[model samples]
Target: MPLTARNPNESENEQDASQSGDEKPVLIEIDHVAIAVNDLGEAIDSYRESFGAVVDHREVVDSDGVEEALLKVAESYVQLMAPTRDDSPVAKYLAKKGEGLHHIGYRVADCDEALERLKSLGHKVIDEHPRPGSRGTTVAFVHPKAIHGTLIELVQE
Candidate 1:
């Protein structure tokens, strides 16, 4: 079934059937709120001191030239990311926009399906297919231009 908004008045059975079909709800929950920073350690420290957040997972994504520190927040995470190289996208983003909100990662049941559904809806995508992401997840990026300047990442773990 194609991805569509559930009717507010739909019966429980109807809602279940729609969601349980070939395509499920694209978004499960907000996996993380990504923040781009100049210094990952400093950002981590700030979160730690300010909000009692601690690093749950940390990884250097060589492909993206970024090092990320994931701080668990409830069922989701606050992902602090810094560019490992000056040429990385995060670095460019920092140079242009300064340290701040970078992207939002939405947990999905199927990354590939979510990506495909977005494409079929005429949304611009950065990744044509799902790729390996930080923390052992399958992920794909949808272009910011397609979503009112907010970069959206579909993450499946």
Candidate 2:
């Protein structure tokens, strides 16, 4: 039975793995995990000193209200995200959650296409359209409401 019809009492549906029947191959890969912190410079220095990893990219995503420093790890990245504005989500996260892992990002060939596919499969999304992201990429956010309790991001470089 399809997931949507499996349990009427369930508040959510699973990922559309069934779409592979005719869809193209999986073109996305886990890109990075973002951690929201109160201090960007301190986090960067700590990671470098403890893990021997250097910041590969750093940028402020004004739209998302975050300043990020990315440390490369094999094919993925460890993103240190800090709020650029007092009212940004990261600021709120730090205030309420007190600095911790925020979201997981999946690298895609086409962010717009991936977001469209996600929406078609009934996933709740934060970004109805793709937007500029840190590290010179395009990105979109998938709402946690649809993906268990994890917030997901689709990134295209």
- The top-ranked prediction according to TM-score is 1
Each candidate's root-mean-square deviation in Å?
Answer: 3.2, 5.2
lDDT of 1 by residue, 28-65 (tens): 89999999999999999999899999999999999999
**What's the true lDDT of residue 52 in model 2?**
98
Poorest lDDT segment (10 consecutive residues) of candidate 2: 7-16
Model 2 scores a C-alpha lDDT of: 0.87
Per model, state how many residue pairs clash: 0, 0
Taking all chains together, each candidate's TM-score versus the true structure is 0.86, 0.84
Q: Candidate 2, residue 141: CA error in Å?
A: 0.4
lDDT of 1: 0.91
Identify the runs in model 1 with alpha carbons over 4 angstroms from their true place: 1-24
Alpha-carbon lDDT, every model: 0.91, 0.87
Colliding residue pairs in candidate 2: none
What does candidate 2's lDDT look like per residue over 81-145, in tens digits?
A: 99999999999989998999999998888899989988999889999999988767899999999
Model 2 spans > 4 angstroms off: 4-19, 22-27
